[model samples]
Structures are given as structure tokens and as C-alpha cells.
Target: DHFVVLFPILSRNRFSHILKGLAMSGRQITVMLSYPSDEVGNHLMDLDAMYKANLNPHTDVLSRQEFRKLFGYTFKHPFTGLDYIDLYMDLAVDNNIEVVLANDPLAALSYSKDVLVATIHDRKHLKNLLLNNGGNTIIGLDELATKQGKSGGYNPEFGLLGSNLAGNNRLKLFPRDAEQFCYAVQKKLFEKTGKTVEVLVYGDGAFKDPVGKIWELADPVVAPGFTAGLMGTPNEIKMKYIADNELVGLSQEEAQRQLKQKISQKGTNLLGQNASLGTTPRQLTDLLGTLCDLMSGSGDKGTPIIHIQGYFDNYASE
Candidate 1:
């Protein structure tokens, strides 16, 4: 069996070095390069072509202009970028490179099995796979937490307090559906205070969870824009603005005051016994905000993937 390794275009030099080392050790290597359609426009084009070819029939095919109009006004193409599809297609034709693997899904539409190896990265493609094979229930973070708490019949109130506040106050059984459970909590909070309150939702690895098992909530059941769902453990609050005018006229001090007031009002709505049992502390909102900033920031420092190098070593030693 041939060993395979996936690397980004940025790591071409490193990939070459590794290949040479393997070759010197009297081992054979087959290189399969993948190029991501980093730009939304190229991604849309591939989707459109795939649909036109009857490979994907559910999605509506749109022109480049239509795609821009529907999504946004801006289309950015990196200056130092190369179209890997074109480059590889020509290479395959000239050199007769068999078993070529591609990152773009549209490559399969043009190249034959002898020339192209299809690799799917799109969410819709994955969902379709699950759907075709007797679909599995994708549970969210809230639901998963509720399931974990069900056996013990944990109180929802302790969810609000600090981690140290764990108690055997089995007031009521937690709902199986996390979103429903959270909504029930929200409703109780509103009833107690007679006011509308925003609820912030945050969790990690919602997308990375196994398809057949419980998944994390991507959006809040009640408030979509108002809620924040983030990956990783919560630590520190980050500020997020809904609109430019939300802080345009206000001084920095005034903005901070408004933000805190908003958070407090939301937290107050989730203050009742039932509400507190199901919800977390107000500080979680800030942690979600920080997650968002890290995700949207430029990747000049490094890749998005966080590599905890010594984590396994420390865990094993402990």
C-alpha cells in the first residue's frame, strides 16, 4: 500500500523535502496535490458546473454575477494564487499522470477516474452521504449536555453558577433536546421577570462531532443573531457589535456601559431557579466573542488548526 500525506500549497517545500527523505530510504511515494477554492466565487462556479452536469441536482446553478449579487458586492482573488485545476489538468494530459487526487469537487466532472480522484470538502456533499445511508440524528451541544445530566437528574440552576457550585439538587429531569431545554429555561426566566432577555449559546466541536452521535448547537433555537456559539472551553469576554451605529456616537466608556447593561439584562432574564439550572454564567458571552475574533483574523501567524504539541505527552505522564 502507498502512503499518502495531505499538505497545503504553502508547505510545498516541506512536502518535497519529506518526499526526498522517503525516496532515500528506498520507499516509493505517490504525490496527490489538492487545491482549495479559497475564493467564494470559484466555489460557486464549481457548484454551478456540478449542478449543470446533473451530478448535483438539488442546488440552483447561478452565474458569477448572480452569485455576487446574492451573497455580497465584493469578490476577492488573491494576487499570488494559481488555478490548480487548470495546472493539474494540463499536467495530467501531457504526462499521463494516473490516479490524480484533487481538492476541488468539480474536477471529477471533467477528468476521468484514471486521471481524477474525487475528494469532497463541501458540507452539502457530506450531508448527502449521510442522507443516502439511512440518515442519523445529529444532536447539538445543548442536547448532549442534557443527555449527560439525565442519569443523575441534575438541577439546571447549577449551570449558571461557577463550576464549583455542583450540587445534588435534583429539582427536575433535564429535557433530551438541548434547544428545547434552553428555550424552556428562557421562557421560565421571562415569566419570572416579565421582560425580554437575550441568551448567549457557546460550545466547541459542534462540527467536528461524529455524524451519528450528538452534535453541538450551531445557532440558538430562539435568537439567531443575538446568540454566540463558539468552539473550545470558555475563558474571557470579547466585545461584539451588532451594527456600526450601536457604538458610533457613544464614547468608549458609554459603549462599555451599554454592553454590560445589555449582558446584565439578558442574564437577569435567565435568573429564575429553572432558568439558572439550564443556563451558564453571563461571562460565557465574552468567551464566545473571543472565539469569533480568532476565527475571522488573518492567518499570517499560522494555520487555523491549534496544535497542542506537548498535550499528549503531559496527559500520558499524568
Candidate 2:
């Protein structure tokens, strides 16, 4: 029987025990580390350290192609164009490799074979799993902004600012603000067209803040407010429409009159219905840092894969 288990992190001792247990149970264990050939050597060195400490050397580390061949099929991932981890799971079943340890989330999904699948979510409370005893914290963008104050620090603006900061300070920092910008652009488009539009944001190497440049380049007559102005125009219309039709269930004319009165009394640019979506940039860098710690075996108790014994006992009993 083959099993697929997803784990956030585990201690070295615990991980060693799992490997020993799997081997003791008369199962051939294969540990697959998702890394390129150039990088696999370093990963193997870390695994070697674990093996040396535990004194269990039964597990085999297979390269991507070698592992794929065990399944007797060549399949590429539809989206990533990489070898799908599902193929390896199927291969494990066919080749009778009882336990296969991997770190890819794609491996966590359901597969065609009857292999037992289990996941351990012990690190749900953790922002990022600490590997092996490494002292590193993975924080989200809001936390990052809070830690380093700047206007719109948690938004797409941060990426632009980060580029300038890195250059000015001569610090090596890579910021991935594409995801956040995509959310903002999508939100703006949705407000304008009332339709959910998918946007693919490509990174332009010039990371100097885009806000001022956008304003300078924009047609003053058409897009006076730049990005925020463009977004606000449709937002105002949407809010007025909602106020007229839904808020008090008033007639269109009366709702417009009341909305105008409210705006005149309070202020223009009032908050809209969908203004609180709060899509900020997540802490992807933090996650990367955590992964680096885990892979280097410097993380706190950092075991990349957790082995759960008797994982299929309930299913087998039933």
C-alpha cells in the first residue's frame, strides 16, 4: 500500500522515527525532494545529516525523471508544464514503494489510485512552519507594513516603494507585489464594469513607484484621478445606484435626491459597498524564508514531511 501525507513541519527526531518505522514495516521508502538538479545536492546533504544521526539508511532519493519512470507514463502539468506529483503517487503504487515523502502541495490533492491519503495540520496557528529549530518568522504584508510604516505599505504601492528603498539603501531585497496589484486592478475593473475580470499583472523591471508616473502619463481630461480616480468614478455611480434601490427602497429620483443631500451634507468620495474587501499583499517572502530554513535543516524541529503511522487503520477497519 502507498500513502500520501501532507505536513506543515516536523522535528528531526520525529521524522527519523517515521522513516525507521516505515522501513521496519518492510516498506521501501523513497524521499522525493522537489528541487532542481543543481540544488538537489545540497538537499541530499541535509538528508544525509538526518540519516547519519538516525543511523537508518534504507530510504532512497530519486531524481525527477527517475521517479517519473517508475510510473511508466510521461505527463506534464497543464498549468506549470512540470512533471505532476500525482504521477509519482501512481508510480509509487505500481512499483510497491510503500511510503513516498514529498513537500509539494499539489501532492496533497486526490488521486485516482486507492492509496491512503492523510494530512497533519499541526501548524495551523503558525504563520509559517519553523523547520529544524531555525529562528525565523514568516509574517504577512500587513505585519510587514506595521513593522515598516509607509502609506499603502500593504498594497501594490509597497512593491514600487520597496524597489526604491532597496536601490536607495543599496540593500538586496526582492518584493513580489504583483499579486496585490492584480487584486487592486481586478477590484477597479469590477467596479467599472460590474463584471469580475481576471487580470494578469506582469512585472515591468522598472519598479520605481508607478503612482506618480501613471498620473503624469495619464490623459488629464479622461483619467484625472489616475488609478484611484478611475476606480472612484464607477464606485460613486455604483454606490448611488445601491443607495437608491436597496438602502431605503426609495424611488430612483428620491434616492438620487437623498444621496445628493447626504453627499452634500457629509462629503464626496463616501465609502462604497465593496470598499472593505481589504485585499492586501500576503507575506510570500516570509513563506520563502521559512522554506529556506526548513530545507537547510536550520528550522525549529524542521521536518519537511511528517509520517503518520496507522494512517489507514480506520479505513481498513471499516
lDDT of 2 by residue, 232-290 (tens): 12112234344644568677687767666543444343453342123232233222223
The most accurate candidate by TM-score is: 1
Worst 10 residues of 2 by lDDT: 215-224
True lDDT of residue 165, candidate 2: 26
Per-candidate TM-score against the hidden true structure: 0.25, 0.23
The weakest ten consecutive residues by lDDT in model 1 span 157-166
Candidate 1, lDDT over the whole model: 0.32
Q: What would the per-residue lDDT of candidate 1 be over residues 1-318, giving only the tens digit for each residue?
A: 232222112211112222333334442223344322321122212444444445333233333234344434232223325433233223332333222334543333333222111121233453344334444332111221232443644324222111111233222222224555556656786899995444433222123224322222222221112322222222212233322435577887877676665444443244443323434443433444334434533237532533122321211132
Task: Count backbone clashes in candidate 1.
Answer: 10
Give Cα distance to truth, residue 203, candidate 1, Å: 22
